[model samples]
Target: MGLTVMMFTALGLCWGSNFIYMKLAADFTSPAQMTLLRVCCGFVPLVLVAWWRGALKRAQLRLLPHFLVMALLATAFYYFAIAKGTERLPSAVAGVLGGTIALFTTLASLVFLRSQRPSTAMLWGVLLGFAGVVVLIAPWQDGAAPLDKQGVFWMLGAAALFGGSYVYVCRFLAPHGLPALALVTWQMGLALVLLLLVTDTSGMGELLVHPRALAGVTFGLGFLGTGMAFLLYYALLERLGAVASAAATYLTPAVALVIGWANGEVVGPRELAAAGVILLGIALMQQGRDRSKVR
Candidate 1:
């Protein structure tokens, strides 16, 4: 396989495993506190990289507001909401639901951004993906909860913001000559500062009292998920263009499911079947898109 494919595959595996790590950490910390720590950990390395590459010196201070909004919406709000919602939802369910961000982004772009119109294949792909979600959740099952009614809605809401950020990045930032690594670095750095200001540090302090918990959150969120995965993603973008790079999102949930299963999370036959359908939908959607853009 090409370097791009390898990078994307690595990105998927790292990110998918992140859900389980986040779930584990969430058990020990409140969402805000967890978000704060994770952002801080992620930001530190990025800042070092930016400083080393002199990306920070070239950054326009006038664009601080734009970067701040993107940070708050994409990193801070997106993560806090997911963490909070996952308090009541299972990792498997959250992973499956989270996969809808791609579909949402496609629809959001067509409606709000006046970007690409949904082709027939894309429409069917979205529908199939959503149907797979419904099947995976099994709303009618005696013990199954309503997918849209629980705290999972917060995750969906987060995904919407995430999708919106993706559109914003593609539509506006990409045209302005912003490098993906620089953009992500600044976003996370700003988000870390903002989150630190408002979040109560009592929980964070308490978390440090437990070395294992701190290490788990730090390594998982910092090195593996945000740091390594994003570096690989940007590398893939440079090597393979955006379309192929963005396709990594399709693999994230699968990675999360495998990790969740290994951690003793139940993996039913229906869930596996739904995952297959979802993957099929993603394949169809990618098949219909212009392969030139990164998405």
Candidate 2:
């Protein structure tokens, strides 16, 4: 459990830092190019790891459709929408919005999956979390970016799809004895093909000209953000249980805020306050789960 908490913490830090890296790369890369490169880079190491572990041979042929759907929802749609959204919003704002994934996942689990209905405490926790996000983004604030309604919508769409994909994975795939690494590898590999189908090679050509941008893409996509972080995340979830694992979502925004500040992004007192509230809300929700277990 202790190790799991540490892994969750590290995953939050790495994923939060991904926003800064994406911001840097976005300067030199279009959304399509960025998604294509990131997915490609992420796929390579996963493939190597799966092969090294002898898991490649165990992959189910019939599960190809499931893997393809996972890739489309989790990688292709999620990353493409997020990259495009981050181009318009600040990294800090993007992080805050991304943090809402847990909230959406909980709601979706209840409504669509019919897994568990949230208790009164859980309901309050959800509301508080949503309020915190609104405060952090402050879409109504004067002098803030015009909110980029389209970008916000896209990010939310990505979050919903990602949440749904997770549900599918837990319900169907896990029971079939799919190892996490193998599943992730197959998903990313399929996503690579799907992305290539739509990506503009001309935009990729423009991105390769900038060494720093290329390095950022390589680091964020290949190692720090996706490859290592996801491996740790699955391990942590296995050890710590989902509630503790989910705490990573709350911590990610704080990490991103620090990274954004270091990158000279403007952050206000209100944002800080909002982050605090969001953390409190996440705590409430997590603790509510504990209470449920006890009951």
Steric collisions counted per model: 1, 0
In candidate 2, which residue ranges exceed 4 Å CA deviation?
1-6, 143-145
TM-score for all predictions? Answer: 0.91, 0.91
lDDT of 2 at 53: 80
Could you give the C-alpha RMSD of every candidate to the true structure, in order shown? 2.6, 2.1
Give lDDT tens digits, candidate 1, residues 122-183: 87887888888778867688865455466667877887889889787877677778767788
lDDT of 2 by residue, 1-295 (tens): 5766577778988888877778888888888788888888877777887899877754486899888889888888889888888877778877777777877776677666555767777778778988987876577778756667777787667777787777888787988988788899889889999989988778566666887878787777557688777777777877876676777777788898888988898878987888778777767876776787688
The TM-score between candidate 1 and the true structure equals: 0.91
Residue pairs whose backbone atoms clash in candidate 2: none
